[model samples]
Target: MNDSVNRPADGAPISVVLAGGGTAGHVEPAMAVADALTALHPDVRITALGTARGLETRLVPERGYHLELITPVPLPRKPTGDLVRLPGRVRRAVRQTRHVFDDVAVDVVIGFGGYVALPAYLAARGGVRRRRVPVVIHEANATAGIANKVGARSAQRVLSAVPGSGLKDAEVIGVPVRAAITALDRAAQRAEARAAFGLPDDTPVLLVFGGSQGAASINRAVSAAAGELARSGVAVLHAYGAKNTLDLRTPEPGDPPYVAVPYLNRMDLAYAAADLAICRSGAMTVAEVSAVGLPAVYVPLPIGNGEQRLNALPVVNAGGGLLVDDADLTPRFVAEVADALLTDPPRLSAMTSAAAQVGHRDAAERVAAVALDIALSGRAARGRRR
Candidate 1:
């Protein structure tokens, strides 16, 4: 009766397939848990399932994991031609996923609720000649997406970042963020991080960015306030979308510098360098920002079912962050609120503690531990059947 999930009863290495791709929101949590699984058992086999069209094509391989691409089955929200063809697309994707499952001898399927997860869930549930495997689901959004809502039915374990993600029985495990984020020492790294970003060490820095592609509204508002912020002794690091351009003026010799980059590869450094952040409140963003203990003014994307607002509200209510509607995020608002906060050390320090309190730093390891246990149990059950 060994309690270790690192090895099965037969001493075979556990194989896991993570299905969460398309968006950074889905892909990041999956990767975080994948990293955690490997850290727990170095010999464990980990694979990622994604489509050619998703960011996982780049993100998965860069993290040094094997990626299997399958036909994407997009769920249409309304009655359309795509909806009519949904069944056939799902069948094809499921068939392709089943092949990957067999190739890897996957013992467990861990899904993060995206276009890539449904087929993997169905394939693992057993159909036709498919073999059944344990399924674990992690829903990272405040509102569960279509794929996760379906996958939750037969999952061996269901997890979510928040309580009301539409997964009624989901265990609240928090969103899984990378270890680099959870282990960050912002105070210790601040000097090096500011230097890395070509920023002044003594200035209060405001880190602003949308998602990977950047947010147009956020970009416009933040960039427009660059002059006012710099004049007020606040340095600005703005990551406008790659495709978008800003019309900000060059800083005067005595003013705090305004640094604008298209993207941020080292978020750990960015978090270390900033006193305050103005950004979108995606589940992943909220989790990462709070995990690093960085205070933020979260501007929810004004679309969908107000899920982004819901994502930020708990943290905001806890005094870890602020919630600003997209429509209200103008230059004047940035000057009055963001500028005032950046200058207030007492408020920022209080918010930092509150944000850290809301973040689950061990979420990845918790998910990995449970997933491994489920995998081991499945393997032992199969052994008994033989």
Candidate 2:
């Protein structure tokens, strides 16, 4: 994979087309790698491919990149109406994507697997030597998604965030996380970050969240134990979903702050302010938390193919965190677990070090390096052939 991206000549420029996004989990990593590539070589041209319906329509552009639209081809779980239309819809999407590759003159196609990735993968393998392009895939989950499984077959390099992702010959490159997280110095920023959240400077905090929409099960269970956690001498930063009306406001006077807000606009600040975290185990969340060296209690969402549970297993096994079943997340259980960890500084310190050992803060640069090498190698290969 490292054949000739040794460096690019003056006049030659590398262009990339990145594909992913149905949720922040898929979109954010793609954006992070794009950012890393631009940082490494400002002249590198980058474009993105996403479905009209995914979060990419908002996030990709907000991150300052052009996003070409494609039809979403979500694999149906069972025999359904959409399943029948899958073949025709996918064919049209691939046709449209081929035009995008031509329009961009894409040197390499990189994908963080999602509903839109299969089309991008198909377009890159244009059925001819002249049109064929090198492909790289990044799998964000411990258990691979269907799109990634297919993309891996033809990808020049396949990268996985955790082990057991089911991508053949996959290299574990960790997840590409934002620079703010990668460069975070929690100790230096702790005073300011805690103050901004109305928390005391010298105290333990438990940051609880359930991704963008918030987790009702997590919220309900945690909120119920708010008093217990406070009595145990820990501050709480609860990001209730924007639509939630439930209040876990501090009841008794002189209790450590239990700051409950609808959403956390600045996640970096939240991470800087917290000592430990209790959140749903999504791939991105696990990556970010571990990247920051914060220990966590991961409650995997009880849906899908049990991938969420799989995502946290590696860290948990490494002594970096704990895993709790969604069904077992009662108020009593949450309070006892959080209190035990918060009150024990030795355990907290050890876990932080363990998480640091497992986390990959420079993964963005590493994955970007692979993508650039593949692109440069393809260009050199073509030139030699000519």
Candidate 3:
């Protein structure tokens, strides 16, 4: 069977429509897949659709891709004043998507899951009564997000980052990580990464980050235990969100040797140098940590429908990491865990092995192949009609 259809004989580029954006969680994976598609098929044209409220306005352009903006409203739970306004917003977004499809002559729509994805899915499924377009949805979290839940119905194939999400017709493709992270040569790169970061080669490195925006609970917990962790011979690299940086106290002299930054622009190096990680369990973070086989002590964000906890479940269950609740995250607790993991060489090695076992290094390539296949299939079907 031809799993991925070959490129058109005319050498014309296949076109793709990508929908989903709001946070880096959604945008980053979409961009990764786009990059992979570009590499695989140099002639592929990628057009991204996102909302003005998302990071895509800056991110998409920075990556040298075209972006179309649409209006999106969050889904409401109860019959409130917001519910009355939702239909109008949804209708507007759907109309905008219809216009985009016509303008771009889109072949296939790939959704990464956000309010922006809803409209694309609706249009692809003929909800707007337009020409049918193939739809694909990728759910990165173990617990499906609202947008993915809606998009799944219209999706021909649903790809998940974690397995056993109970969604029918789903493939466990793992999460797409940036190319840099996936390409790193762990053994050869480790020492160089440590030297570039000005960290001692012999010190046990502990990478701490709470997503791009940073987590307040994690910041506080790490700060409180900085001294204790330092005494236990662990070097900490903390990426505190810009907004939360002011709230953290400057570590005094002789404390855990930490290099604190507002954000880490070079994540590959951070992962390369870390022997262990303490972080919130965002889907992307979990995937990155697992990709590099960096063992972690995960403290899932205790808010917003338990999505973070769900993201970490598979790793924890697989013995790739430890799960700690945010409410239970204390200075003493973090220090104890960090010390235990850092000091025990055999246990740390085992966790690292497990993490590597669960990582899908080819996720981006696989997802890109699926998108290209759908686009090629659509083109073939159109030719037959003629």
Candidate 4:
């Protein structure tokens, strides 16, 4: 895929459009690569394509990247009325996306499979009057989603978080996580991290959280066991969802602090403060937790195509962590499993080492390099055609 293509002239500016909006799982990876590209080539311009309904409406702007809004064409799971209208919805989104490409003079398109991606892919393949741009696809799930599967057909390069993602011959580059997570040193920052949360310095700490909005089942189960865990001298730093509530008996002066917050703005410090975690096994969550070498009892959400379970499988199989079913993650289960791991430092240490080994800390830079190459090559190809 890297066969020598024409190279853009020295100091020439390059532009890229990233199409991976909707959820944090898709947006975070896209942002990480965008950051990498900026760090590597200050002259590079980046734009993000997203729908108004997705998290990107806020997250993209918050990250200081320009976001272009497009009409969302949500694919219905069943043969509903929405499915019947899919073609026209797709046409409108594709048209809007093509306008963004023309306005930006986009050198290349890098997509992390989602509702916005299919339109972007089709737009990149310009019509008879327009020039087609190179396309790159990154599948961040264990199984390739429909949009990614379709994009891969014409993609110049295809990447995956794991093998067997159903995008045949795709390169395996672990999920792209921000430098903050990839560079975190849990052991070295443990003291300061604990102090930040008011957690005790000498006790085992268990961190509990759901995704951004929070998981109700996880909140109920973990909060129910909070008191029992505190009595056993285990400190808790729980980021209960901003939308969820936790009822807890106030800790006495001697009891290890149970610092409950609505959200965790500093996940690096959170990872540093805890020896283990009980959280949902979303793709980004797995990448971040495992990247920091923090052992976790991953509880995959019971819904969806079971992709969450697949996301954590390699880590669990590598002995870096354990996986428990959502239905089995009761209050008692949390208490027992957490106590067993926290009390056994040797086991925890082994698990930590395994987790770190499986984490591809350089994944962001690796993907960024390939994406930049594709952009430059496309520029080169265009120049030659001229």
Top model number, lDDT: 1
- Give the residue spans of candidate 4 off by over 4 A: 1-7
TM-score of each: 0.98, 0.96, 0.94, 0.96
Clashes of 2: 0
Lowest-scoring 10 consecutive residues by lDDT in candidate 1? 1-10
Clashes of each: 0, 0, 1, 0
Q: Where does candidate 2 clash, by residue pair?
A: none
* Model 2 lDDT, residue 317, Cα: 91
- Taking the tens digit of each residue's C-alpha lDDT, what string does model 2 give over 260-358? 898998899999999999999899999999989999999999998899998888889999999999999999998999989998999999999898788
Strongest candidate by TM-score: 1
- Order candidates by lDDT, high to low: 1, 4, 2, 3
lDDT of 2 at 287: 95
State residue 38's C-alpha deviation in candidate 1, in Å.
Answer: 0.2
* RMSD to truth, every model: 1.3, 1.8, 2.1, 2.0
The residue ranges of model 3 lying beyond 4 angstroms of the native Cα positions read: 1-6, 127-129, 246-256
Tens digit per residue, CA lDDT, model 4, 161-206:
9898999889998999999999898999999999999888899999
